[model samples]
Target: MAMKRNGKSPVSSDTDEKFMFFKDVSLGPHETQLRFRLIHFWEARNPVKKTIIGLEMLLIDEQGTVIQGFIPPGRIKKYLPDLKQGSVYRLNNFYGSKNKPMYRVADHIATVSFTWNSELSVLHEIPTCFDEDRFRFHSYEDFEANCDIKGDLYDVVGHMKLVNGHTLIERPTPDEVKIDTTRHIMVHVQSHDGPVMKLYLWDQAAADFCKKFNSYDNTPTLLLVTAVNTKRLGGTLALTSMSPSRIISTGSAQTRRLLIKQVSADVVTKPWYYIGCSGCHAKATKGATSLVCTNTKCEKINTAGVPQYRAKISVYDNSDQAVFVLLGDAGRVLTGRHASELVSSYFEANGSEGADHLVPVPEALISTIGQTHKFCVKVTQHNFSGDTRAITVTKILSLDTPSPTEASVGNDIAAMSEGATQSGDAVCEPHKGGGVTADEESKRACSSADPETAKRPRCEN
Candidate 1:
């Protein structure tokens, strides 16, 4: 006979079967009953094969002990229809199997696997309370200790210092195109007074972060990520999101700006711009009849090509010196002229040229030398890999106020004057007649003929 608890039918106390806690579960078939709350569940898939391995879950008992649970692909249909995130459930028969060591989300020695005859039912009346959720947060030092170990995955909470090198409050433009094909975002976060650590969010985690970040009127500074894997990149500890990872943001926005003074342009070594796919803004290759995007993930097979700025310049500040690559919108923010407009103006006046036509460094970019300005830069895997010494600048900040690019659309003249502070140097627009002056044409002709410059790999987006 079942007993009533708080006006609801409770598990029958008169039953001969005894209920066991998660801690008591051992490796073998368990005929006894186990009660737990389903904290969360996600599909586990084989990365290489792209096949579903099983449905993985986190379960918590009345004792607040959390354990990993799994339902084989064959039995998923039996239990998935009734599975709810926070619902309390009872399992009659389950197999106790050893938990996999790699990418373990919960600190459990064994996993509860559903058997062919296993029965899952909702608990109408819970006898005891179960914790709603559980989290294991690790400090920077703790993560550093276990870096690249593939041990127990943990959670992290901190104040976001940078998102793709932009401040926490900075938002991307509606039409902004990202060159990174992976769509991953890198964030610098610091917990308390600890050192700053890099967190890379990929795929769904990146989408969730952007959704939560933009939902608020003011940007959220505090960040919390669950089940993150730690890896050492360039000998520095970095945290990365896993398939089961979750992102949470709260608290007020914090701004930390990075400013630098333009020392010189490196146009002698690298071209100032690249032809990119109009669809995805990735570098485009010359196709049989048309240009094609180099990004394998791009949907467009044949796409129109457009010239985009990718200027490399040496920059210095009171602290140190570094090379920064001004790409796409960042170049427009500094020069007040789009790369397409400049390329078109040059070609229209000089006549159509070959694919290797080297557009001279625009006077607009050269005019910014010795000027100090704040910049938004992205730190990519290339930076960690030491493949490139230049950091990609995403946006340029004004000296007096935030650029209209960050606020709303405004007058181009006003935005350029405020956004890019010129050192009393005259800003020269692209020459509409013959593309270049005698002096500038001489410089371009010499650079174009140089075997070394021609041998240097073209700058990729």
Candidate 2:
């Protein structure tokens, strides 16, 4: 009573017909049925037409071979809503073709496109052995070898040693019609005791990463990035996230163990610098009469610059020694004293209105110098002005030496968590008011205080 599309009857899950693996899929006119788990998927919009083009999916069969799946716009109302990521499904009546190398998100050599005659049904009794493939991870050498070939994706896992806040850039999309102007985070990822690679997270992926990173009470020092496109920018190779990319906040078990081992080992640190710009928390330069923010785009002037405490420390393990910079909030966490309070104390110790009117390094912060602490330092290098070498600290984990003033810890904990509570939800701007540009919004975002000296508390709610 039914027509056999491929010179054979449609096979059901209950039947004994051999299961079709993803690798078996080819550019054939015959109907082939398959059951696969949807690993990841995303909706695409026609940039020129401004209409939906159904969705793109990455699926894996029991054999662990990956294949690209597509649903055309005509079938959107029927299949798009029913399809869920990470679910297994039985499908048939799709056509395969050699994938477009220029737009390949997955490494699959073949792609399947759904047609009007395609059929899909949810599969409840999936084989227990069916699991997502552990991707083939590459190293710096592999990156160097393949970076020139564009549109190829790869996997990387590393310790998030350095995390820069955010930078806005305008990028052209695949169509070259619409430009995506968004914020990107520059993260330095290092493999197991190996070389470091630059990773750039743009738009939503960047927001998600920042949220999980700062919001959690105990953030992860390691991360796993899958489906990263290799790009050579400014004479250096970098990893970038595509639409189907996945960023694991809590890195794999192996990486977590490595990070723990690295942190717990005999790591010693000494305080280096004591003051910085209150807004971005960059090292403040000694101006003619006041401190100037090293960040050139700073909205506030040097004289009006709100003074915040920064700590630079020399870190030494058996292997090597490095200098780390800790901004206001992280410094406060380590010393159990707010930067503003320390600055106020400095003003009190020395007469408030000196020729420079600069706040001296507070005793509370100075005591930390030459002392040892266990810090979760993100290792990144910045040479915007010149090729200066130093290790940058992204976050502070713990202090080996107990706080001298134990009572201050209880008082400081509340103030320290105030900013973190909102970090997961908001963008980098902690105290953001309506602003004109992305750069301006970041500048106007609330920190501890206004640049004006009259402002009492350094940070605003």
Candidate 3:
């Protein structure tokens, strides 16, 4: 028992003594990494009379260096710890620099994130495991039935115009303006199991088109997609993300139940987007199409042209049981702002709509992109010696509907920017006495030129 002096208890005001560890601590140094945990601390009054702080330390990998440090008042004890006295920890990091030592942390005990020298490459020596009772999948064919994914799907054989040669860069006369491309012909595919898959295509027109942009050597590229701003072309589409769709892939017998965790990170996703045109309209249906026209009817067939369309793929490992890392960009498509703008302009210019089809290309494509959901995916990374490394992917999965945009008849992506300006509950903007016309504003809106009665999807392509 301590005696009271001058109205206060005679306890020591030493924070270090009171914060002494009470349980055993452990620290393991792997590669250059040091993983440790603080069990507990206590303050004991020794027989000699003065206060002594007792810290139970385990100091893992006794030979490896352990980080010894101190904590100040209002900084040491703040919340519950994830680790207990006998708890174990495994951190894939390095022994930090003493010169640039770590700072004193308040709620560091319960923090889920840890700092490292740089982006560390995690070694996956063992295969991930899963219950195999969850997840689902849909091939390019099913994507076809639901989406406008074109190609000789059932033939098991098709071609993807990698690069187009006959791109009309020169200002077209009334002649050049008429012949241009605007539709995308996606070669449907089948979903299979494995650690790796190949998605390459071949096309004559695309290959010849690619040759024009080649250096003096006349060497053509198998996947050299360049973006150029043209009056009539399409924008590019990257696989911003790849989560397992409705279903997940598991071991042969357990395909029904989605293995959410393992496959989650295996998919791919990108934050920003780079647009580019895919292709041009074929012969036959040109003059009949009209969306934002002056006297209304302005349609004519343009020549054949296919713009550069990028590729994005996501792989999955249904063996693991977590999905936090699955939503991310798969670097499958090209990443140049020039390429992005080129693609965006294509969809903006050549793309038009008929009362039947309703939507136009390039610009219409942006609207389509806006309507689609955003997702994430992970890939298999290969780690080498501390000096170097490499990585490759094998499977792919599209996870659940993680994030989808809200769309309504009056409120669409085209109007999203305008919607934010008006009062939250305010009435719609009234056209200045007259309805919307071509010269009034740039590009066009979903409600542009008055809603011309709902109609069927015109078979323009």
Candidate 4:
């Protein structure tokens, strides 16, 4: 007789919940309150059930809290395969590492989620080690042997040992800062073919990885390098060819360029190379353009005589769906796709619903961008002839968010936002395939490229 209370319907807004269940949550020691950006999270049941039943969310945070996000209770027991994939799934439970807290429906075993509770987070990330000739990874030494070692540097994969009990491994969130300045790093790798065999860090975040691996080297606790998808900055792109005395060339500045060579244990990066800009962010290409870093909005153009343009993106509406505002399409000439396609794909890989939930062409999808910073984007410059003037992504360390970005913006806008929450409705930003008005563009890109969500059924028409 009553699905109404205080004039509100039983089901409030999609995110709206009964005030009773909206209990305040707090942070604990050894457990900092973090903003987890859900990636791809899914669950399935036993013999009785057929398809994967639950949602697979990719949740990451800049506060070093990178892993799967909270799984609101009732979700474990009430999942339907046919349910929209991008639909927001939330739950309140103790997030942990390893077996215990995978999924607890009634304070009982969930049986469908990953075996992670407190001690070990799931295998959310893999190290970036691969060959330059092709996108294949050097997960094993054999993989690298096949690649023609053009220079003194060689690509090889093996177990990496971390020494300390609690070492600080860099969290490789897409929006993490790239070491903009060039520096020297120590490394140790076995070189048999004239010191040509180089060591590759599996992922960019693994840059500071130092752990205690049981002598064998296969320990899951041990950092596994060389077998990641090898697609982004952190993905084996920082390959440093080495010599017994000096280090050779560092990798490329282009986004999606995989790392080819690397140092294994304790080799150091040479003096000539710069760390590029912070991850997810971009810098100028040599002899092409030079610019200073700025927020996604109000980005400044420092490069002169070149077609230097910048894009400004913001999270809008009560939902705060992430959106980008590009200044020109010339940048697309370098990336081969239009500004909308490139920008859309960037968010698709980094957004909440990922590429699948991308809005229709010429329509930007309303969703989170990379990690916690919704406005993060990859920027490049081009000549008037449509040739690549330079390619650089512009983003900052997500760890600096909330404190730097939010603290400066103030309460009015922040208070009304979903507060790092994702929505299912597709908010379309009006965009033109060949060039349309900013108002005509939708809020998000199509989800055609999200790695995990491509074939997965999501909330798309």
RMSD of each: 22.3, 20.6, 26.3, 26.6
- Per-residue C-alpha lDDT of model 3 across residues 259-366, encoded as one tens digit per residue: 223233333232122121122111112244422222122232232222222222222221211111110112222122233354446456646633232111132222
- Residue range 1-461, candidate 1, lDDT tens digits: 44222122223244544677788777777776889999889899999999999999989998899999999999888889999989999898888899999999888799999998899999988777888887786656788787899988988776666677665444442111342355688887765424567889988788777777667776566677889999988776789999888774544331211100111232444678877777656567788998876555557788898887767666654334456766667688888999999988887878867657777777787566445677655343444443345565545766765433522333443444443421101112222322221112112111011111111111212
What ranges in model 1 sit over 4 Å off?
A: 1-17, 169-181, 249-461
Of candidates 4 and 3, the better by TM-score: 4
Residue 9's lDDT in candidate 4? 24
lDDT (Cα, tens digit) per residue for candidate 2, span 1-461: 25445334443445564346676666644376788888877776776996787688888887787888887777778887778878888887787767767646667777878876878988897754567644656656777777868656777776655566221121111211111344676776665423456789876667667665655444455777777887887766678877667765544466565444543322222222334555655445678887776555557576344444434444543234454455544566778987767666766767746744544345575445334456533221231222323333333545543333435644554555543422110113323432221111122222323222111111200
The sequence of per-residue lDDT tens digits that candidate 4 reaches over residues 1-118 is: 2533233222232344321111121122122112222333434333275544434333332222223333333454443342342232232233332223322111111111322232
Score candidate 1 by TM-score against the native: 0.51
Candidate ranking under TM-score, highest first, comes to: 1, 2, 4, 3
Model 2 pairs in collision: 161-378, 161-379, 272-312, 273-312, 304-451, 431-446, 448-458, 448-459, 449-458
Prediction 1 global C-alpha lDDT = 0.66
Report lDDT (Cα) of residue 164, candidate 1.
Answer: 76
TM-score-superior candidate, 1 or 3: 1
How far in Å is the alpha carbon of 131 misplaced in model 4? Answer: 26
